[model samples]
Target: MAVSAIATPVAASSGSFLISPNVGLMLWTLILFGISMFVLWKLAFPRISEALDRRQRAIEESIDAAERTREESRELLEEYRERLREARSQAEEIIERARRTAEVHERDTQAEAQARREQLMEQTRREIATETRRAIDEIRREVADLTVMATEKVTRKTLTEEDQRRLVEEALGELDFSALAPAREE
Candidate 1:
């Protein structure tokens, strides 16, 4: 009986419509699938597409902002480099000006020192000339007095002023006084 029952169920299942192709069921399944697709297209598809579009726009805006920021950074970097170059040029110019000023100051100082040295040398020469003249005059007076005294002693008579003047003139004319003067430098 159990064998018969199992054989009967297997035979019935083998002839069942579920295992065989049925045009009615296929048509009904197709109709249900189309209805479900139409419902999703009308309700879920628009919301999903709108969300995707919003995401795409947000991504594009972020990219645009990043690009703008990169361009601004590039501009700022260029500006900084330009400013640095200007600063270096200004620094070099300042150094050059200072160098020129220092050179001028050095030259002026040397020239001033040279002028002072020349002035002092001229003053010393003048003083030496004045002293030499005074010494020579003193020597001349002494010699004149000595000559008068010797003349009076030798002649055994007092010489008059005229005789003394004549003798002194003759003695002064015989002496060479040029050697007493200082030699000129140039």
Candidate 2:
């Protein structure tokens, strides 16, 4: 029995490296390995691979959605900037229009004031002319009365109406009206 066991070990070694002489054990091990591979291909491995593929697809969808969101945010930012620029332009235009309106109103106010001043000046001139004319007329009447009295005293008698009128006319012709009234400055 010991010699037979030794011969079997030698024959097994001569055949191949790491080979055993127990055929039944090797056959049983091969059958168990095959069953494990079939079970993995049909059930466990397929389920695990499906789970991994589903996770990969989900990741790809999430990345695509993130890219779309980024694009949309960029467009919105540009749109908001354009709106802000338009608002600023409108504000500047409004300010400019208000300034122009104020200038026109100021000019109109100045023109009205100038016209009123001119009207007041013209009225004053008319009043002064009327007063001057009245003064001159009063002086003429008093001078005529004095001349008539002087003549009557010199003659030692009251003169007739005709003689008084003739003497008053002579006095008025000798008087210079330009000397009594001053020239007006333009």
Best by TM-score: 1
Candidate 1 — which residues are off by over 4 angstroms?
1-41, 144-171
* Candidate 2 wrong stretches, greater than 4 Å: 1-53, 143-174, 182-186
For residues 63-134, write the lDDT of model 2, one tens digit per residue. 999999999999999999999999999999999999999999999999999999998988888888778888
CA displacement after TM-score superposition, residue 31 of candidate 1 (Å): 7.2
Error of 2 at 45 (Å): 6.7
TM-scores, in order shown? 0.62, 0.55
Each model's lDDT comes to: 0.89, 0.85
Clashing pairs in 1: none
Listed per model in order, the count of residue pairs whose N, CA or C atoms clash below 3 Å is 0, 0
